[model samples]
Target: MSFQDEFNSGVLEVISPSPAYYPDTSRLRITLGDPPERVRWRSKQNLDFAYLMMYSQPKAVFYDQLDDILAKPHFITTMKIAAYDRIANKQSRFVLDFCQLGFIGKMFRCVELPWLVQLFFMFYSDKPVDRLLENEIHTKVSLLATDDAACRRAKDELWVHYKPSLFQHIGTQPSLKEKLKKSGNAEHPSDRFYNTTVEVLLKIVPLSEASENMTSDGYVIIGKFDSRCIAEGVVSQKLGAFSELRLTVHSVSDNRAILSEIFIWGQEAR
Candidate 1:
């Protein structure tokens, strides 16, 4: 079944905890107002904010362990959740980050505590906008402490990530004011995505005379004869090392072929 279908049928569960609320149905209490300029630097701290998308088996989390962490006064609860989940399940979780549109060439993968770090930055960081710089520092430090705790439990390798991101933010508008100011370049098209096909160009060049007449099986066929030394073709099948390319050079005066270069083009190749 599709992931969404499974999620709706209770075959899957996504535990996305918010920073604004506690397990006891009470809002987290924190100072409210603008943050001081000195404390603003702390906001730039690098935190793993890529754990929003994770898949796990049912009952992976031990409620007892989760409760133990939640009972503490930590601001980054998502990290704690991930830590205990690993402890109980004894297995790694796959996390994916949203791929920005128009950035297909720059796709990458890394292990990260996805939703855990962003929770503080997205929800709680702005709540105490007017708090003293010291309070802000304390809050930021508390977030880091929880992150450290989670990392200690969930090793760096425990988090596996998929490449050519499968997820992307739905809309073009940015949710945060800082991002909104740069919204013009914030949204673009993504070239790669999970389980999706992409178009690529394949070119082949003769490294030497030995490779010119190499057999390419039936994966490619000569499409055009540019010159006595140059040839172009279309890939009839997926090209690979096993697809032995054979170039039969033919001369105008003598029935001899001398291939200088070969160009191959197709919808996809490997």
Candidate 2:
């Protein structure tokens, strides 16, 4: 979809789902059936600020605080857009045509980008006329610049990017040119992407089996035992944070039996 359409729909869904309510006593109690087109245009300009933020490298601390920034009453004004345009024109397009296919191999390490831009290339292209211009411009940089310095300069002049990318490319297959038959290794994954998996390891032992001495409490038992002789089993279950795992132990006969040990190990989930 066009950026304008996407922006309008998103605003309708998120910012103004219905006519906003105001206090009866307030001076601004008047309500309109629909916001004027100019108001929508101003909102779109504010959204352009979001794109500008994503393109430019802001302080690492503010990477995850974009929502808070956008919540401000006057975050992006028309004056700021005009000021930025005066300093750095966003209208210019940098097109670099590759005449030699062999030159592509040597250009691999020429440009290093944030994970988000890398992800755009993995699943999108400029072949289709309807594709977003931003994607086309971003992917075009690698072809336009021959060295790291040139690429870095282009990025500084174009848009902002955040460090430790918020999203990762996890697909094991390519989506581009899917109509053509292709084979061989197709995995393309981002190395710098943040790891979101939360793992937890739990160990349970009978009250009698647990060490009475505080010094020896560090030791844990992790070994195998015959189920016939000793009732032992491992259950691999997914659980959420602060969830409880209850274990019930019973003896084959009426006689009392002690549950020796239970061990579970995995990274703590976040």
Candidate lDDT (C-alpha), each: 0.31, 0.30
Off by over 4 Å in 1: 1-123, 126-156, 180-270
lDDT of model 2, residue 110? 14
Candidate 2 lDDT by residue in tens digits, 95-145 = 221111111101111122244333333322212211232444456676888
Question: Against the true structure, candidate 1 has what lDDT?
Answer: 0.31
Question: How high is the lDDT of residue 56 in model 2?
Answer: 45
**Candidate 2 accuracy as TM-score:** 0.22
Q: Which regions of candidate 2 fall more than 4 Å away from where they truly are?
A: 1-135, 138-146, 162-198, 201-270
Residues 38-132, candidate 1: write the lDDT tens digits.
22322322111222213231234321101111111332354445445555877554321122222111111223323333444454334322122
Instruction: Identify the leading candidate in terms of TM-score.
Output: 2
- lDDT of model 1 at position 73: 37
